[model samples]
Target chain A: MDLLLQLTINGLSMGSIYLLLGISWGLIFAVTRTFHFAHGATFVVAAYSAYFFQQLGFSLILAAVGSVLAAVLFGMAVEGILYRYLRKAFASHLVVFVAAIGTLITVENLIAMGFGTDVKTLEGFPIKVIKIGKVGFNNLHVVMFATAGILFFLLMLYLHRTKTGKALRAVISNPEMAEVIGIDTRKYFLLAFALGSLLVAPAAFLVTIERGATIDLGHWAILYAFMPVIIGGIGSLPGAALAGLIIGLAESIGIWKISSQWQVGIAFVVLVAVMILKPTGLFGFRVYRGKI
Target chain B: MILEVKNLVGGYQNKRVLHGLSFSMGDGEVVGTIGHNGAGKTTLLKSLFGLLPPWEGQILFRSHDITGRKPDSNVKEGIAYMPQGQGLFPDLTVMENLEISCFGLDRKTLKKRSQQVFELFPILEERKRQRAGTLSGGEQRMMSVGLTLMHEPTLMFLDEPSLGLAPRIVQLVMENIIEINRRFKNSILLVEQNFEQVKRVAGKIIVIKLGQIVFSGILDPALDKRELWKYF
Candidate 1:
């Protein structure tokens, strides 16, 4: 029973991290339809940026703000320089997909070159443990859970209550008509990329604080980020977050019950099963149907 | 004049659909362009609204050059366009559909503007919270037109407003358009395949065939000439 409780707490903490990653991926994918595989690179780059900035004697909060802003600028640069031209050239979705994959490879190599191939760690934060019954959670887990909760709440409010967010949805719903209705499709595309990067920044910071920063983690980051989106439904942000938690829990509990060697395979199994059973995902509605 | 196009030539890719098509309209005028399918009516409207860049010639709005400008810029200049078929964000609610148009407006002004749209179409007000996709065809058409009205554009371009609608709903849309023209004092360039309906609302009429204007005159003069029916 104590082992089960410990595992459950661990799963919830892991779930918060996955939720952040999945929501970020979901935002960019929902609005831009870019399938931005380089999102993982953005995550790790942010982590490294925060680390290096903190090493330069900046405070942790200031370092986080600066690094997140840098990440956002980088994401926008990718959109402005690469994706925008690809779209203007009327490139096929397949071509864009290949280009994004190429970008992911290039960014990962750049990070590895700049930050070194070794894992870099942040200075230890004041560690405080909170225990409930037989389960225990560290301060890092509490912060991760709190940040994820606050961000998700704010995101939902933005989507439902704000005009610009609604315009973003409008673009997602119908691009051509959105333009006709006078929404700047290009501007919103940039916003979508920026928002996705913004969501990733804190999670990147959290990872560095908890474990450490590694360049190659992007490979696993993409899977953790994308699986929730695929399982939750492609265009649904809340669904992605929920699916992230589910995948996190499954991976943690499943690994405990089975062998730890099969940890990575849990996400793959859930993804395949969801695709076969309910392709639209748990909360996805048909978007951009038929002709204009 | 509200808008003038001189020898405009453009089309998708290398296919030049509109060849030297020229026309002009004065302020507060409701002009209609009538033609058969594949006659370039939709293409002409798309060009005028800056969705398609003109290969040649110039477009002047309020005596300023606007050739090849983007659709959003045209909207800022008080021009709104509604494309053919169901050109709406079906996933949005009626209120969201209306609110998106008034994006440039401030919060208080947006609230006031929404109330005005609700007054224009009471049914929209009643279904403000419902998803636009679930609405009936006529209701969707109303929401589409209402979306244009939210910005209160001075020049409106409507492409096939009556397409795929019941006759009764068509009549309702036409009536609402006339009301919109009267209340807003907006200059309208309406494109439609329905010659009879165009004849009812259009003070002036232009006819296009194979991307060129074959006729441009008052509706009565063109209607009196039975041979002109062939162009329509």
Candidate 2:
């Protein structure tokens, strides 16, 4: 029916944003094994940075590029300054987890201090709607889909075809063995964090442009991002994207059939179902470390 | 001397495995370290290659102290380590495994080295696209040895190359090691439990027992296997 078509279009558009968030989280998690809860903070930082630059008389595209670059630098800084020292000190997983949570709180507070605690809006995004048979498409949605599609293609190419990308995969596969093979796993870790942060940049800007910015946006970003990754495999980028789309579709349909209040809960319902059925997500495999 | 480990002491947290172990190897020398399961042979190799840094004494490579350098730095300095259990990225393909071994090399060199690997082990060529995890046990061993050669290291540490392979495959692996040593002129430190394999490939033999070198000398065919068994 017409309703189904409309829901599907909305789902796909939402899927594009969720896919970026999932991939960004998955990248850093897969490489560094840091459950990077602070990604939520970085998401806010990037959006706010974009908003700041745009307000500074820069073009939207230039602002977006600058924001993404800033996010990457922030990601690297987090790893180098916080996580690296903890790892060197042989900190336990719980300690590292607590540290990550601490980082999230610190960054979130900083954002509120710099940008106001109140929700802020981003203007100037031209909203031109196009009508299909029974569904409508906005220019922003189309742009979101196109950007997601193009970036996904490029990411796949980078992961499978490039040397540094393969090095990242190697580190993810067996970090200790990767070291024995002369791979500087640290460099690959930085690359993963940077790439992951970079992937989220456009999504941050687009979301701000579409829905406006809020202090709570980063917190919601983590939830939206992590659910897809958990539903997919933790380290599988393709699965994360696929799961993102599935969650988005489910949310759209659920909102239409049920109530709008349950829209966010739909993704979690799917996540719980997936956790019970397939614990490793869709594409997770055991990473082989050498036996002693 | 290419490598000299002087009174080196190292182990896991609180459990010292190498208790003042000392040994030295010259260029192009294939030193065989043979020991029982708990004799710390693997630990010794791990310490030398920087997997576990020595707690005491010095590790001199080309007269420079590389006592506790990181494993990646050691590899870059011409030392390659292939640990037991065929330390490989099992999910990656044979080509991927070879490529990752010499990461950061130019595409042309990567391709050329891959070709050379195929030539060294033609079976690897046939399974270039196959996931390394799914390969047969013998094939996995071959791929492990082949990977270390990708970087063209001047010094190599092979931990238990013949640990879990058929007699036929063991022969093939030993042959490959001998050929690699001759061709690359690499100083090799081979740790293995199989005394027969050790005697076959190593000109100098060192026996480790309870984290210490009990014996060090040239391979003597006249020496009874029972005599070495007693030490282990």
**Which has the greatest TM-score?**
2
Q: Could you give candidate 2's per-residue lDDT for residues A1-292 as a string of tens digits?
A: 8998999999999999999998889878888888888888788889998989988998888888989998999888888888899988888989988888788788888888888887666677789999988689899999988888888889878878988777888887778789899888888888888898899888999999988888778789989878888888877888888898899899998887799898988888999998899887877654222110
DockQ of 1: 0.57
RMSD of each: 2.7, 2.6
CAPRI-style docking class of model 1 based on DockQ? medium
lDDT of each: 0.86, 0.86
Clashes of each: 0, 0
- Weakest 10 consecutive residues, lDDT, candidate 1 chain B? B221-230
Candidate 1 lDDT, tens digit per residue, B100-196?
Answer: 8788888787788788778878998999999898899999998888888777799999999999999999999999999999999999999987877
